[model samples]
Target: MSTKRRIATLIASTALLVGGTVTMGAGTAAADPNFTFKYSGTTSNGSFTVAVYNNGTYAGLAEWNADPVSGHPGDAMRAGDVLSDGWYVKAILLSPYRLATTQGHPATYLTPWKTGDLPEGQKVEMRVAISNGTTTYLSQYYTGHA
Candidate 1:
């Protein structure tokens, strides 16, 4: 193709790509009773982050009017079980695993999730799991994107 033609083609391709990402984001996972998540996808990119909040109520973060859950036992957030209790995000989709653990209890933290090559709107399904050494609490499976 000629130089001018090539440039025009490139511009058209770019527009389509940007538009596609927005369209793909339309299917962003619905809010789960567990926690809240958000993702805006882009071509040729991967990984995303989600902030987990503990709404002090039975409904968890899903409840808008709930109070902030307090008491970060041990005063720190942890992935696996430790001396005390904390909170973490568990990917319950394909291979279940723990993502980055952020602040817990009285505070909210963001978790960085890897969704390798999230070019075509990758979907992330996970739940906020919390434990207090005695009982483990969970939010609904929050669906988000990357």
Candidate 2:
């Protein structure tokens, strides 16, 4: 083969290999959707509601199992409203491989009830409040990627 032709073929092969690697990495990242917060714990914290926010806009609230059949969890929020649900979500135990402390913690699986399709690495904040008619617990803030 001519030297120039051989060089061209090598360049083409390298490009193909690089492209294939990038595509495969993206697929792996997508498949392992990371949940930002896993809820857990038992307190007289009252009914729990969860809403997802991207930037300053309200994405939506989880319909949750309580209203899974109905498809709407009965309430929606505007840009600045405090988000809540009529009940508390179960908490999750972080993977043993993870460094998160498991002591007295409750874990809630959030993927089932979270608002919408959240792309990886988007900055998000979760606000949670527990209320029991006369008493309302303070809202807690958890910020991370989704």
Candidate 3:
């Protein structure tokens, strides 16, 4: 292939890869029974809610932001609220090889969660990553649902 053609091909390939990654982490519910799901949010001392809907053709997340920012709903966690905490997303599960973090992401809280098009009807699994602003630690994963 020519230089220009090669560059174009590489760009297209890179775009495809990046696009694939984002879609995989999306919060939207899928028809695939084995598809995984992910969720994220930014909160302070307040708590948030995660509502799951798997009925008919309408299946996705319906999160209610906490007080001072309540009375609204969104598809993405918190929709677009840039709270004190940066962002804490659901964690992965049961991988032999894994990566760890010592200095946690800038967040008021963390949920080391079980995700991936989360299995229908199964309790969502998660862990708490307590951070002292600079350092962090992980907790054992627990099973729960919306």
Candidate 4:
């Protein structure tokens, strides 16, 4: 009711709001450290490589490919194959599907992979599946930590 009392109440409310926001932000940042997914190289005879990192440390690696089968135009890779590295074929996002003959070439997809939490400063290796057309294969090395 009094002007001085009203000013004090407003200041207290502002302080509480700012303090709560800062606390919430700090908690969230501490709970989730930044992680990254970095991949490179193309399928060589069907194999490819990918890497995962947590806070700039090596988290995991996956190298995989589809094996070429005799007589068949495509490798053994499929749309749902899961490798030991917790990576799997998400979907055939884009390809030369409309062209009947170009189907044997490599296709690209926005692959999605999921894994459990990684302990700080630790890493693990695992196999991942890559596809060339309809064929899929496993990576050669392991590299992920949890």
Candidate 5:
């Protein structure tokens, strides 16, 4: 084969190999659709409510309490905290809590969630975190809809 032709063939073969590898890796690296419930708020010493709505109708509710921690009052819920039914809570913190911080991502294998227990196409009103009483902090809401 001519030298120029040989070099062109080699380059073409390398490109094909690299392209094939990338195509295979793309499938593995594809991210799964994320369904998460997340919220954050402040409270000195009070209780907060996490509520889920479906099609403008009330569906479920979960509550957490804020108590004193390190001389600062706060509340938090961890991942795998099962709400009523199959609702699970997962929190991805943006940063470490300072004090009086309450936050988490809540989702479930139920209605109003992808891969949820409930059927799809349900209109989720809002996932809201509210702090009330004397130690009321800012109320946070999860704006994502299912």
Candidate 6:
């Protein structure tokens, strides 16, 4: 086939693939709450970090708010402050053998809780990694029980 015809065929094929994906609901994957738990907080422009805690102990940082509801957690932002936000997360319930003692303690995720949706018997803390350009801010952990 001619060069022009070849180009046209490739473009048409690409469009068809994309359109099929949309028709299958590829864009609505985030709307499902069954995939993760939700948290709430705020931050400034730049990259923010989230760490998990359990019973006043640090578990790790690999699984805290990794997948955000709208975007991946710690996604880049414009240069400025931001409003408090909510985060959807999934709990690491633990593997076989060891009992799941990490329940109800926010699962030691990086993202903070919402303005008024934290669970009881849990203590959440956040440290703003201050920088010359980027800044971080989070709401106080709204413990369910004082």
lDDT of each: 0.31, 0.27, 0.30, 0.32, 0.29, 0.25
Candidate 3, residues 1-146: lDDT per residue as tens digits?
A: 86434533553465566552112223333333222223344344222343222222222222322232343322112211112333233322222212222234443333232113322233333333322232222233333332
Top lDDT model: 4
TM-score of 3: 0.23
**TM-score, per-candidate, Cα-based:** 0.31, 0.25, 0.23, 0.26, 0.24, 0.17
Q: After superposition, how far is residue 85 of candidate 4 from its true place, in Å?
A: 16
- Whole-model lDDT, model 1: 0.31
Q: How close is candidate 6 to the true structure, as a TM-score?
A: 0.17
lDDT, residue 120, candidate 4: 39
Per residue, candidate 4 scores C-alpha lDDT tens digits across 1-146 of: 96434533553465566552111111012223333344454444443445534356553443333333454222222232222332232221111111011122333322223222333323333333232322223223323222
Which has the greatest TM-score?
A: 1
Off by over 4 Å in 3: 1-116, 132-134
lDDT of 4 at 32: 32
Candidate 2: tens digits of C-alpha lDDT, residues 31-86: 22211222232213212234433233342332212211345331111111222322
Report the C-alpha lDDT of model 5 over 1-146, residue by residue, as the tens digit.
Answer: 96434533553465566552111110112222112222333233333445433333343343333443554323332223323323233222211211221223343322221122212222222222222111111112322121
Name the lDDT of candidate 2.
Answer: 0.27
How much is 121 displaced in model 3, in angstroms? 1.2
Clash count, one per candidate: 2, 18, 8, 22, 9, 7
Query: Which residue pairs show collisions in model 3?
Result: 35-117, 36-116, 36-117, 37-116, 37-117, 37-118, 91-113, 124-144
Expressed as tens digits, the lDDT of each residue in 1-146 for candidate 6 is: 96434533553465466552111111112322211112333222212333332232333331222123465432111111121122222222111101112223332233332223223322333221111112111111211111
lDDT of 4 at 78: 24
Q: Which stretches of candidate 4 lie over 4 Å from their true place?
A: 1-31, 68-146
